[model samples]
Target: MTHRITVTGRAGGTPGTGRRVRVLAPAAALALGSALLTACGGSSDSGGSTTVTVGSNGNIFDMPLKLADSAGYFRKQGLKVKFVTTTASTGTSALQSGSVQFLNNSPTGFTSALAKKVPEVAIAVSGLGNPLGLVVSKKFAAAHKLAAETPAAQVAQALAGSKGGVSSANTKAEAGLFLKANGVDPGKVKWVTLPSASADKAALSSGQIDWFITSEPIPLQVQNQGDGIVVVDPKKAPMWAAAQAGYGEVVVATKSYLSGHASAAKKFVAAVQEANNYLATHQGDPMVMDVARKVQQGVPDEVLKSSVALVEWPASGSMDAAGWTKTLAFVNSLGALPDGAKVTSENWTNKYLPAGGQS
Candidate 1:
């Protein structure tokens, strides 16, 4: 390593006067400083294991990845996990630009990437079922005579001509699914794009929105705040049970990155699988509960406890063709899949899996 320091005599010095002196020195100090900051984005360490950044949606749904990190599964696999702050909108682009090595999120980002010819592969799956919950404000529920066990038709009728809070493309799709499943015309509903989870609460509490649909534990959080109650739990819904997709929540890496860091990618999937197993069997355990604490902001333990209990982690981490197909179908139902964009082998695989139960 080398460092060249140039010292100029004065601002007014003539360029031809040779006033600038260059001294060449070893860059040990500079190199040492960089070495101290060992994990730089997705860079590899020459003397040790691979270090990379993985982006999770930072919600309760991504808790399995958080468990992998908090439970030392990443370290066990000799992978240093640095979390990069990413949203549904930016994660895939970050993955494409090499700023993020892996993204643990919904299939939407990866699917959208393939639409533009960006090759990212789904290497692993952690969760199996849809965990979205629909909560309606007290006033709306009371006025509509809605309850958790309300008939689907009544729920749909109650939702008609009501304002619902949606945060992103995903939420809007979820809301659409709720309406379409119950045979309600989507035009009959009004969607308010409330950007944050807190915004979901604020809108509902102020009566700005009648219903809000989102994944746990926001629905649980809303109920805890006494603003509303959950009217739909996807886990209990027949629609989700019939079309549950493992690709609903998965780990994705760019095709090029996986080609070079296949070993690291495999190790990551295995670690996440181990974490998923722990979460499935040990939801009540303090450590499993703590993953939510690490990633989620203001949600409480009781809410997370109930929310985690509702989430069903697949026994295996490996993904299959059918699950991807089902997920793609669900996205397509939302009018989300870009035209001519198909989730082919290029966009996903089970080659990196540990080989076990269905996912």
Candidate 2:
């Protein structure tokens, strides 16, 4: 139980401010478009397809939408969807301003934005389940006598004094769900912010963090490199039973756009649903793997194969009420729907509309 503080800290100000800036990124970004932090999301591509853009933070749960772009599902819907690569620390203001047509995120993400009064609604469902894993450094695992099959509560107990590597508060929030479910105080572990993906692995390898939490391939890669052990494999029974009750990723857009552009929105969602269907059937196919590599770029074959298999692509991109009910419980504990969001067994569709998404 040695406390190791990784001193890879970056400055928080223009030149000499040694203090870290503390503010809610999404809310601040929304309040002042000055920090809008744009990566650009929309533009026409080819043929006569309408240009649409979706923002992504590279969570493996977003694979279904990426597959849609690669597999011509977007073309099939007369749309050319572009992905705006972004960080988990930002909000959906870009969607509201029409910089992006859709924002691919988890329920926790959307709820955080909604809590800030950002007017957006989920138009489609993507991946489901927890899609996240807890990777303990090999040394830490050996020290605590932890293993792949360790019970969730036991692992949670062991984390009472440990540092967790997180990309942002969003990652921490998502991980909080897992900790909350395991009856552990999420704040027990000191979260070390490592914004770059490369830094996450490096920090863990250097024994700077006791554990790391992230989705897919990262955990798989860590295991491959022998730097960490998968204590909470999202693919396993115990992990799923504990944390897979909520929506993993959803496609959302602003209410103003959805109100006027229902046709495009529905078409876009249809394409995502089609891609998910194909992914559900052709998971291990060469073409699927190729698309995965293209979308996830730089991921090794073994990692992609394992991640693709484990990442649950919801059939037809639908959401069920029971799943959503659990989602509400785990996400902010309110049975009430997201602001301007409606529900159906199959999908949220245009939840903003009173008549089941019909504008």
Candidate 3:
């Protein structure tokens, strides 16, 4: 069932740069044209295999999809999925340009895309448990008489009126929702935008900022380096954890792609279920670690193992409508969404879910 199809194209650029260079715009346009040509240019020769190019941010959340590929789940489903490490924004561009058939990232990114009329829809939930969390420098926590075990709401209150770093405006909005839900005034905190997660981690260690909210393994790294303590574990956050879990990481595809390739999309969704089931039953197995290391390079095995325990995958790869509603409510509350923008559960459908409870 192994079908070899070489995906010849440009990868989406590094994540967290926060700016798309004008000079590269022309090149990207060319790349997009090339992608469209290949996809439409096809009479596939892979013994009827459907190649599903996937654009990803290279985050650990994408682990299950990568694991599925390594386990030959895609092959079993008659698919060849090529994963490209592109920033979320760039992934949207790839989706539009037909460079990739599937996109993986936070549903926040998909929400933004929908605001722009991107027409991408979430087919399945990837992983859950808010990947983002709050971390404070040991000195700051000590100065404020805060213990590593302090409640997250109390920590947010203590950090009020202080400078904190985040990766983006959307990220800041998410932090704001969590803090405000816990009775802290997000307006009181000054949010500094760091270039990347590594930059935020460095800033946190150097005391350049009082506290920052970011996703793992930076939160994991901060704890490992002993420079900070995780004040908020999104999985256990007092008020907003469950809401955040609704749309953490999702597998998305464009409406156009789904219309023309409905069968392939369903197959991909089934493969995701297969992967989630594997993780549910075999978490921390050597095979899981091997796949995790392959997908989340540069991360220590222990951190990867710890992260697995932190995240939960939906057994059926089902979408949560209530959770999705709560997520949009918070995003709108911040006025971070585009004008007249709304994301209902209709934006995500479970029609493609595999039958008989795949998990």
The worst-scoring run of ten residues by lDDT in candidate 1 lies at 17-26
Residue range 1-359, candidate 1, lDDT tens digits: 24454654667766655423222223655565465443233445665767888887776668888888899998888888888888878988888777788898777667877888877888887776667788999899999898878877778878889998887677777777667878888788887888776788788888899988877888888888787889888754545532554456788888777876778888888888898888889997889867777777667889888888776786687766777788888777667777877888667777887656334
State the lDDT of candidate 2 residue by residue for 1-359, as single tens digits.
Answer: 12333544555545434333344545654544422212223334336567778888876766777787877888887887777876545647667667787888767767667666777777767777665667899899999999988987888888876999987554577666667777889778798999765688889999888888777688878887787888886644333422445677788887767766777777888777778888888988988888888867887888888888876776755555666666656554423235554343433553422233233
Model 3 lDDT per residue over 183-223, tens place = 88888998889988888988988889988887777787777
Deviation (Å) of 109 in candidate 2: 2.6
Name the 10 consecutive residues with the lowest summed lDDT in model 3.
1-10
- Backbone clashes (count) for model 1: 0
- Candidate 1 segments whose C-alpha is farther than 4 A from its true place: 1-47, 355-359
TM-score on alpha carbons, each prediction: 0.84, 0.73, 0.82
Cα error of candidate 1 at position 52, Å: 1.4
- Hey, what RMSD does candidate 2 come out at? 15.5
